[model samples]
Target: MHILLHDFAGHPFQAELSRVLARRGHRVTHAWFAGDTGPKGRMARTEGDADTLAFLPAGQDLRYSKTDFLRRRAGDIAYGQELGQAICAMKPDVVISGNTPTEAQEGIQRACRQTGTPFIYWCQDFYSVAASRLLARKLPGPGHLIGGYYRFLERRQMRRASRVLHITESFRAQTDAWGIPRERVSVIPNWGALDEIGVLDRNTAWAQANGLGPGTRFLYSGTLAMKHNPELLAGLARAVTAGDQVVLVSAGVGADGLAARAADGTLPGMRVLPLQPFEVFPQVLASGDILLAVIEREAGTFSVPSKILSYLCAGRPIVLAAPGDNLAAQILRETGAGQVVEPEDTEGFAAAAQAFRDDPAARQAAGAAGRAYAEAHFDLERVADKFETLFSEARNGL
Candidate 1:
């Protein structure tokens, strides 16, 4: 099968999916906005460069965030038409896109209609107004207006698409709120990108580079985005008892604010390391005694994060700071591999951290469980098989 994949966010999952499909003998072509913060260079078509399919004309990039929905623009329709032309030439067996804003999705759907392709919307991020309410709390009038407009466009896209690949079971419930039928949605949670997951001996390097000791290492990797309440981890760092140290290695531009928060002498046991290439993530993760996945308490948190999958695959115990009802927390409970506490409950997080530091046996047991669970459920090869089955079923009109 020939597949055309559009990922405005360029998430590693998209690239991992493409590689898995290619390995399975499918001709997979991937497209995305290179500037997207998620995947970075992982999905580049050529060495050191983004794929031409992901290229966007200057001043025409259609970015959609919580605040982007209210501003109605003609550029969206133009971008949609442009995408339609690109897919028309591919003559793909299927057209699929992930994390595309509704405005861009409109264009992709129109393109699929024009090219007679089966379109699938893979919802990694829920662009619901509830997300804005949860994160921003008080959005400006313009933001609210944009949110309303995008929601309407998303509803339209749901009606047109052949299927919706959701990152969480909760995502389907959210889409159903917009009237998408049950048959049109499928659940495929995020999986570890083995291509991105490689070894890095950060522990040995940390001693020479940062003069760190063999303290119980708690690691925080990835971006310092607003949704990621890393400050909470910093706050909990002050409560670390005995020989526990929190090592924060943040990447990308989003780390600036988090760095500032960490540097203010607010969190005693925490240290912020500079960003490194994405390739070293697995090694950095391996150096840690526990991995911290923190998110703010809010309505939209039921959404799953890609980091949880990566942490699980690293075979490290996870100290997740999210609502218990969230998919991340639920997965932890289901796997019996990690501990989940409510977001903003710094005392709970600190206690969990102290308990893990004191109980090595318990930590090892949980870590082993997480690693096994990841191998069983979140492995790229296994996930790709499920995706291929879904694609075949959708194309066969089953």
Candidate 2:
């Protein structure tokens, strides 16, 4: 079958799945938004890749501003149109799309309908719900109404889809509320690139070149969005003792602000760097003494930080600042991967980071547990089997 996989963020594991499917004697085209500035995967086609595999750009190189709703919405629509044209032209047997704006998803659904292709809604997050909250805050009076329109569009598109794959079971509530048939939705938790993200030595060339390691380093490598609580990150930096460095390898408005502050001496003892190339991602993760992640209290279970999964693969103990009920926090609790502190408790978060920093034995134990969990759960072969089954079902009019 000709399969088109559109992952808006161009994440690592999703691209790994595409490679697996391609090697299985299927024609697979992995597509993503090249303009996106966050962590990306092995986007370039390597020489060892099967001839059946192809990587294509589906979104334009327009200025991507998350805070500017009007401009972002226009970019979304333009991307949708471009992706739709590709879908129509390729006329693939199956299309799986996720991490997309609702407006762009609508266009993908439309194109699938036009081409009579089976469209799978890869529901990574409740984009409508997040957007609704964002719009409500941005346009207090009528923001809700505008947000409702997006919710309606999202529900309609999911309802129209042949199958819907959710990244977390928390999405079950929304799908049930959407009145989508119970059989149409399935939960396939996201995984890390087990083969890609290996555990490298802390003193990797990348780490040494960046002057990161040989000392206690609390590292964060991901999208540091507004909802991620930048102040807590700053608090973590401030609370760290002198000679300890907080390194942020990230992007997003919040991260940019933190970087600016760090540069201006307002936020000290922090080294902020842009997102690094995928080739050096393993070294980037390994350079840290302790991995760090954060989520606001208001976020609850609405989002799962994919960084946590990747961190597990990196065999690093994580210090996550999130609510107890948040899935990532729960994973840490279950796996004994690292420490978890309430998102709002700056003191607790800082203390946890310091504890991990001062105790190498504790860090080693926690890191071992996380790597064991990753090895047990992040089975690419098993994951591929399920997706292959879904592809067959979707192609046969599921």
Q: Pick the candidate with the highest lDDT.
A: 2
TM-score per prediction, in order, is: 0.83, 0.97
On a 0 to 100 scale, what is the lDDT of residue 333 in model 2?
97
Per-model CA lDDT versus the true structure: 0.70, 0.89
Q: Which residue runs of candidate 2 sit more than 4 Å off their true CA positions?
A: none
Look at candidate 1 and tell me the lDDT of residue 205.
58
lDDT of 1 by residue, 106-141 (tens): 878887888778888888766554445543465667
For model 1, the local distance difference test gives 0.70
Mark the 10 consecutive residues where model 1 has the least summed lDDT. 50-59
Error of 1 at 211 (Å): 4.9
Q: How far is 214's C-alpha from truth in model 2 (Å)? A: 2.5
